[model samples]
Structures are given as structure tokens and as C-alpha cells.
Target: MTKTVQSRALSLAPGASRREMLNLTGAAALASAIKLAFPSGAMAQGTGPEVKGTRLGYIALTDSAPLIIAKEKGFYAKHGVPDMEIAKQASWGATRDNMALGAKANGIDGGHILRPKTHLYTTGKVMQNSQPLPMYTLLNLNEDGQAISVSNEYRDLNVQKDSSPLKQAFERKKAAGKELTAAMTFPGGTHDLWIRYWLAAGGIDPDTDIKVIVVPPPQMVANMKVGTMDCFCVGEPWNEQLVNQNIGYSALTTGELWFRHPEKILGMRADWVDANPKATQAILMAVMEAQMWCEKMENRQELSEIVGRRQWFNVPVADLNKRLQGDINYGNGREVKGTNLYMKFWGEGGATSYPWKSLDTWFVTENIRWGKFDPKIDIKALVDKTNRADLWREAAKTLGVPGAPTADSRGVETFFDGTKFDPAAPLDYLKALKIKRVA
Candidate 1:
């Protein structure tokens, strides 16, 4: 059977595309042929992924490493998806827009996305189109790599992890009729949430205390250099780029706000997954392999090089390497030597990749806390529908990893400010926050 499948696959025209092959021989036959052609140790005998070419989108952030790595290192091809396309989006908004376009429109099948944004997309609260675009998270991309950076002017203000020092500066600026401007990658996104939480933790209301603006990740340094914004929160290379340019200092890493907090996620449309379960599993399997590869210490150098390429992140490899290896220089004469707060792709105990429903609950509740959505919504049900842990388990199992665990919740999550968030009582957690817009 293997020989027959191999012969059929080899018989196709050399330059024929996967879609063309599918049109010629149907999806099931193409999947079988491709499966036989590129059999991995974990490949099981079953209906393989549909042989449709997937255009996976990603922003120019370091957390996008897994998707780029999978495409660059042939992991996607090794898992019987040879026609995967890794697209570089301009910003998170563009990424979301493309995902909403779906595969038929030549948009993305999926990509790295903010967890809560997926909820917003599905609920039709935010989008280019009003129709609800139901989505699900297959796995988390990375954790602990995002940071808040302030201009060099704040270096002497004694601003460290807390924003207390900036509060006085903010008041002076406001008195002078110049409202201090703060920037994040997206409104109600992870960076926005992180910056808001950091500011509110320091008694600064994000909405009332300052002017918050949206800036793309790659353009963060340029905007900061021109003194357009006082401070900004975004994912790596940009934060590290600011330090490299000597224009700003890393005031705080997001990991310092909430240890091992969820950052980017592998989000896909639910209807896409439902229609193409095998293809979805194949994509997840490839990413799972890439995640394990990215977690290794020895592979950091190569990983950095691959992601820092002109086509991918378009940044210097050195800037990307520093954070990945945990050798962080805060650009304020404060050096963190060998910190464990480096970006984690796949840690022990299934911490990084597993799409814990609890994290989703926190994201949704925070959206409510920030007044992006109403508090009357069912948080648990939203999490259950948006987070597809069952799909992650299926992919992990296909990779020869352990089966799905008994529970989906990661239990109570604690923050650096000593605030505790129990997923079971999200409203209680919201009520505990002193500065919030939620009624």
C-alpha cells in the first residue's frame, strides 16, 4: 500500500500545486499519497489532513517564531502539508482582518492572535464585517516576551517596575495642557491589557490618566524615537530595538506584571476547523514539533536567525537572540543576567502550549473589566466555545505525547502585584480591581 501510494504521488507533474493535485485526484487520495510520501514517526494510519494550501498569517513579532519555524524548517511539509504559506502581516489588526477573510478569499486559515480578540471576533463585537466569525485557539505561541518601554526622559524619574514615578510626570504634563500619551499595539489587545494593568496597578487610570494610541509593533521604535508617545507596550524585537537604539529603556517586562502570562495564540476560524479537521490536526502537529524544537537551549541561535530573516521579522538577529536566551539588558543600566523570564515556547507540565480555558476566562473577564464587553455575558461558556483544548490534545496525541489531562483549568492565576484571579469567580476578581471602567 505504501509503495502504491508513493508511486501515485510521484506520478504527478513535478510543478503541480497541491490544490491542482487535489482537483485531479480528490482530497482523500491526495492526503493518502502525501502521507505515504512523507511519513514521520508519529504519523498514524487514519484520514490525513485535507490537501488544501493554507495561508497562515503572522505579525512581525518574536512570538511569531513557531509559525515561521514550522514553515522554514519543513515541519509543515514533514506533517503532509507541503503547500503551507507563511504570510507576514503589517499589524495585529491586519492579521485579524485576514483571518476573518477565511481561506476561500485567499486570506489566512489561521495565525498568531490575541486570545480575547478571538472572543470579540466570534461575538461580532469587533471586525471589518458585522457577521460573527467564530474562532478557536489551537495552542499558545509563547509567553513572557512582551514589555513596557518608556522614553529615555523617564530614565531619571526613578521609574522601575511601577508606574508611580510616571504619575507625577503625567500630572505635570496634564497641567501644561499636554496629556501624556501611551501607546499599545491594539486597543483591547494583549499589549493594551498589559499596559493598562500596569498603569492601573500604579493608580493611573488608563482611560482618564493619559492619551492611549495604537501603534504597530514594527513601527514602535520609530514612533518612540520621534517622541510621539511617552511609553508603549509591545512584543519583542521592537522593545529590544528601542533599547538597542538608546532611545528608550525597558521599564517592565510583561512577565513581571503576570508571570507566564498568555501572549500570542494559534487562532483559527471554527468553521474552517469543522470543515477540515484533518488539515487542522496536521497544522497543529507541525506547530507542536516546532514548539518543542524552539524550547531547546541549543537551538536558540538558529531559531533567532530563522525568525530574524528579512522576510520574517526583518530585524537584527542579535536583538532577537538576547531575549530568547534570557540575557536581558533593560537599557537603563539595569542588567538581568540569565533570567527565567525569557520567552517560553514549551515548558514542562504542558504550561506554554495548552489552551487552558482558565486563561481564556481571564482574558474575557478583563475585556469586561475594561468595558470592551458587558459583564452579563457567560464567561465560562465563551471560554468553552472559543478554546479548543480537545483539538490540542488530539494534535499532542498524534505527536506521541501524553494524552489530554483531566482538567482544562489552570486554577487560580497570581500576578506580580499580589492579585489573585480565580477562574471560578472572575466577577470577584474584577471587583477586586481598584481602577476599572466596568460598572
Candidate 2:
């Protein structure tokens, strides 16, 4: 897809006053001018229920932009949701559990979730829950430019650039009598799923021959240098960080799988929305606006600054911005431009804030494929339950950005094995799988 990211930047302060504006056409100065003239005010036409207070939880990642942008840009307050205590949780599991407990017990109302956690919590197919806090995906963060990187030793073994080099590296490592270990941030998360999928497609056994471990993003580089693992498949800055430090090199990027694959979503509990429909709708509208703002190409430098702050990803802006703009450095002193995978606002590259059922359905199908949940469940109904695109459309239209977002969140995925996955028919896909499923 040809993206028309407006070259805009956030002219606001470091913390909350900052608002990113979308600039189309790559006109840098025009994009900056647009950021200066963004239409920010109380949203009209939404008669949301009165929200006495608003609270949301998130873990630090670039994908958390919608939530961060919504807050910094005053979209929440404009939508009548101010005084939210944006808590920085310790881990992805902690974030989800905290939100689950808080939302359920009248603590926090909504949260950001790693896609798999959202799927697991919302469906309760395997981990049965009393309240199934059915989550609706509000919007997509970005099509991640995730990658799997390996040590310099593996690179010398002849892993190429055009494809999944990490997979090839794994094969080379096996021949060398070294067990390949790959690290992902969260289990059942996009990082984990992508890494495993990448490995499996390369003919490596993600479950057996290859070992998988969960490591925080920040620690990935350190661990690699110390030999905790050979390579890590993770989000930008981390992968880029590895490249800059000369400890490793890029094997393959997850975007290589599907460049525009849905990577992250705004997730909230079903009961939370049930009691606060107006509030939920308002929140969706605010985040949707933020998604658009992030689409601007010019606002990237500023975004890199905000995301790199200690309060967020806690890294240097140079490291963050270098990759944010697609200029990549594959450690061992290699640099390549056009590798930035950061998603810009105005729904960069057709990425919307609202959940696409097809995206959710894809995750659901993968959830069953990886044995994270049961394949016997009603996957179709569950996907529908987990995605609130219908609600998001109503709110987005009322808020006046545009008309209803499409409900194209369902489809079939054809893999290299000549396998077809109609997410609508996940059970059949599961039955046809060649790999063993966990009992």
C-alpha cells in the first residue's frame, strides 16, 4: 500500500500538550504547518455517558501510541475523560491482570493488551474465567517491522538479506551443534507468535528442536551479548539497538511475513463497555484521532522523543528516531534506509484504530494453531465478541472524522505449505494442520 504520511511533527510540550498532526504527500513544511493548525477541541455529536473519571493501563512499547497520543493530545479530556491515572505496569501479564482485576473489581476501567492476551482473556476458551471480560479491539497501532536478529557468528555463516535470515541461521547453528534459542517478550503475544511462525516456516521446530524464551525487550541486547540466547525477535529500537551495537545482525523482519499485518489493538473488557458505553465510545473516538495523528511522517522525530523518554520506552531518542524513520542499522556496522516500521497517525498505511474482525479472527486462528487455546471453541462467535468494530464505527462516525470503518476483519490465510486458513473456519484449519497440537 502506498502511504501518504503527512510530514508533520508535534509542536507541543514534552508531556501532555503535544499533539501529532497528519500531513499527507511527504511535504515536510506543510506537515509541520498542519501540526500547528490541527483541529483540536471538544468532539461534537457524541453524547457519551458522563465519565466521572477515566483510567487506563499500558506497558511501554511503540505500539502504545494511540493511548499515549490520545492522552498527550488532550483527546481524552476533549472526549470528557480526564483525570485518568495512566498506570505503567511491570509486565504484559501484569498489565492485563491488573486491568482485569481492576476493571472487574471497580478499579481501572480499560487497558491496552498484547493481542494474544486479549484473545485469551476475552474468549476464556482454555483459561475459563467467571467474567470473560470480552474485549473489543478499538484500533490498530501499526504494522510492526519486527525482526529476528542473530549473532555475528551466524551472519558469517551466510544468512542472506532478502528473506528470513534468522531461520537460515538456525539451520546453520544446528549443523554446528549449537542449540538455537530465540527470545520473545511475551508468550501468546505478537512477538512470540511472529518469532515462532518465522521459525516454523523455516523448517525449524519452534516447540522442540528450537528453544523459545521470554525476555523483556530492553534486556534482549544484553542477553545476546552475554550469550543468554543467540538472537531475539522483537519490536523496533531493540532490534535496531542490536544492529547499532555490533553484537548482532538482522535475520528477517516480521513485516516480511505480511507488511501490513495488524500488530496491536486497543482492548477493553466487555463489562466495562456494558456499563460505560458512552465513555467507551468517547475513548474510541479519542484514540482514533490519535491514530490519525500518528500517521503523519513529519511528526516522527517528536514521536521518537516521546517514546524514548524514561516514562515510556526509556531509551535515547537517536536510537528510537533512527529506526522510526526507516533508516536501519544492522549491527556489525551495517546501515540501511527505508526500514522504519513506525506507524503514523491518520491510521498510517490504512491502519485504523478500530478493530478489524479479520485481524482478530487471524489472531484467534493462530491462538488455536499454537495451542495457546482450544481449537474446539466457537472461533467465529468468539472473534465477533472480541472485536467491537461495530461500536467503533458508530463512535467514529459520530465524532466526524469520517464514515463507519470497514468490518473486513475476517479472511483466509494461505501459508507456504499450501494450507488455507479461513479464520471463519478455524476449527477446520486446526484439523488440517500437519504439526502436533498441545493436548
Candidate 3:
């Protein structure tokens, strides 16, 4: 029997009693190989490429589920990979730096990293001195999962809420002249972008209007309770944790803003992909398939265990499961409507995994507006650089994933606010914008 078939059989093997593997870390072993005569041609293709070794970097967050899932599931081996080791980084900054200067530099190769960090480094926005190697664009992880949580004190302001809580909340603070502080994971990540976007959407000037700080996800709650921040926009567990502990109340969820916005992407340096194209495609195929498995409600507990494991997120199963299911508990006696904001295990289709060109355009425009990059580069060129739907199509085709992605010549779409985002002609969209850049 071929190795691919052997690997697939192992991955399909039924789980040992659920009691034996509560977290679903590893499925039962594959059946002993039965002597099945294979045709000579059977060994030709469909056997995934050879993978030597990869040093993938990931921060401990619920959204890191995809990487964990890929590892836990035999998706890697099934795709004809040799071995892989996941390196847990201290922080996002450390992760990006490690990729820029680690085994990839002197050892094996650059490991896995966050999508935006890769983009910033490539464009020389975050680090001024170094020229970053571009990373392969793969599947997106979370969409619309960011949450802006506030200390329970906001309830005391008697803020009247209508469509826009942020605006009303800001008005309440202004009427009372109360100072507020909010936090994000990074200056340009979804946490920060969502927090600031929500603030601006409500007519609050994110610059002088309020103080925004950079706090890691694990530290958000502690920082808030310690008076370091009045509120925060961060990924799951932290948001739910605050309410679970009665530390803060959630003001709004980013998922509520647009339902589906790309949050995370599987990232690898361009040099690595160029060096190991087949191996890279194999990893992509495995994760994309794993993502499909994760979208199902039945796989919830299994996924929770894989991502919640001490090695990955180091968080308790109870904490991860709550937000994974979209059930949000806002402080005491309040629960935000449970919604699938995390999109933890999205497949190729639906609201979860498609590479939305318009979405990419919005992210780039915001990056420009925030002064992260000079926006002087041609938006079209940058969009092409940041998004690789063409590469995605090749990987998807290899995996037999249906509905190949097609770039819209018509460009990206316009949002509800009457702001048009054209992926192809980003410069035109930038010129027509009504908002002011940070300068």
C-alpha cells in the first residue's frame, strides 16, 4: 500500500474510547498494514511532497487552533510530510523576530508567523532597519472575533445604547468627563484595528479622543483590573474570562460589526516556500482540510482539547470552550448573544475561509490611515503582494477543494458606510476616501 493511503487510513481510524482521550489529542493507531498488492503506477502521484523539518512559531491564543489542529491531526503526515516541530514564542514581536533571525537565518528555516506581522515586516512598516522576506499567504483563521470589553463601571454611566454603543458610550464619558483607556494586542493587528475602528465608528477620535495601549491577550484582564487600561479589544478567552471573573463587561464584538472579517492567516517566509514548495503546499492542504473539520459543532470538544492543550494555549478547557461556542458571559448577570465569531475551524467555503479581496483592501487602507505604512506604494501593487489568491488556488486544487478562488477584475467592494474598497485599484479608492489619515 502507498504511504499516502497508509497515512489517510491512520487519520481515519476511529478514536480510542472518548474516555481514553478526553481532549482528542491523538486518534487510535492505524491498522496493521495488510499486504495489498499495489499497481506500479499507484506510487507515481497523489503522494504528497517530502518535508524535512519546519520550525513553526505561534503565540498562545485560541485563534492558534489551526496550527494545533494540523499537528494533532495526521494532516501533515497524510500529505507526505516527514516531521514538524512547533515553537511557542514569548510574544508576537518575538515570533516575528525569531522568523527573521532564527533557524531560518542560521538553522533550518523561518517558522510559522502571524499574517499581519509578516505583511508589516515585508513593507518595512513595523521594523525600519530590516528588509523582511515575504511570507506565503495561506488560510485565514479567525474572522470578526475581536471584542471591545470595558470595566463594569461603564454600566454606572447610564449610557443609553442604540445602534452604536461606542458613540453612546463615548457621549456618556464626555457628559461625565470620565477618562477611558482601551487596549489591543498590537498597534495594527485586529485587536487594535477593531478597537480603534469601533471607537472611530462611534465618532470618537481614536487619537486624542481616548488612550489606547498595547497589551498582550493574557495580560488584558490583569491590566484592566490594575488600572492600566479601562477596556480592551482582544481575542477570545480573555474577553470571556473578564466577564467570567466579573472584571469587565463586553461593549461589542467585532463579529457584530461585519459578521466576517479575516483575522489570522497561516504565514511562512517567501524563501521557505521557494525552497520547499511541495512541503509548503502539503502543510497548506492539511490545515485547510483541518479547518473544514473544525467548522462542525460535533468537533467542538475535540478542537477545544487540541487548541486548549498546555503546549499550545495553556488555558483551561472550560475557558476555551465557552467562547468557542459563541456563548459570551458579560461580567455578572449578563451574557452577550452567543455567535460564531471565532470561526475556529472554518472550511474552504461559507463565511469562514474564503479569501475576500475586498477584506484585504480594507485592512490595507486602514494600515495606511493609521500611518503604519506610507500608503505611498501603489495600492494595487501592495494588494497583489499581500494577497496570493493565485497560490491559494494551486494549493486548493491539489487538495481537491472545490470553488477555486478567482480575482475579481472589477476590484473589491464598497462597505455599508459608502466607502468603496477596490482590491485592484486601491489608489483610486484611497483618493476618494472621506476620512483623514493619521499623518
Taken over the whole model, the C-alpha lDDT of each candidate is: 0.85, 0.66, 0.64
The predicted structure with the larger lDDT, 2 or 3, is 2
Which of 1 and 3 is ahead in TM-score?
Answer: 1
- Which whole-number lDDT from 0 to 100 does residue 104 have in model 3? 48
CA shift of 56, model 3, Å = 1.1
Query: Residue by residue across 1-439, what tens digits does model 3's lDDT show?
Result: 4565555444432433444323333333222221122232234333546455587776777677766777788777777664766777766667666767646464324443444664676776665375665755555665655577877666664222122455566667757977767788877776777776666655666777678777767888888777667668877777877877777777766666555667877767777777677787777777777777777777877887877777787777777776677776655466655566555446444235555555666677777877776767565566567565666677777777666556534245544344556665666765664444743
RMSD of 3: 10.6
Please report, as a residue range, the 10-residue window in candidate 2 with the lowest summed lDDT. 1-10
Model 2 TM-score, all chains together:
0.79
Residue ranges of candidate 2 with Cα displaced over 4 Å: 1-48, 103-107, 125-133, 158-179, 332-334, 339-351, 410-421, 424-439
Candidate No. with top TM-score: 1
Instruction: Supply the TM-score for candidate 1.
Output: 0.89
Cα-lDDT of candidate 1? 0.85
Model 1 poorest ten-residue lDDT run: 36-45
- Candidate 1 residue pairs that clash: 49-278
lDDT of 1 by residue, 1-439 (tens): 4565557676655455776566534567777666545554125434556664488888898898899889888999888888989888988888878888876798887888876778988898878766788998889888889899999978898476788889988899889987588999887889999999999999898899998899989999999898889999999988888999999999888898998999999999898889888888889988888998999989999998998888787789988999888888889888887998789998774568888888999999999999988889988888888888998887887777754454788899998789999999999999999999875
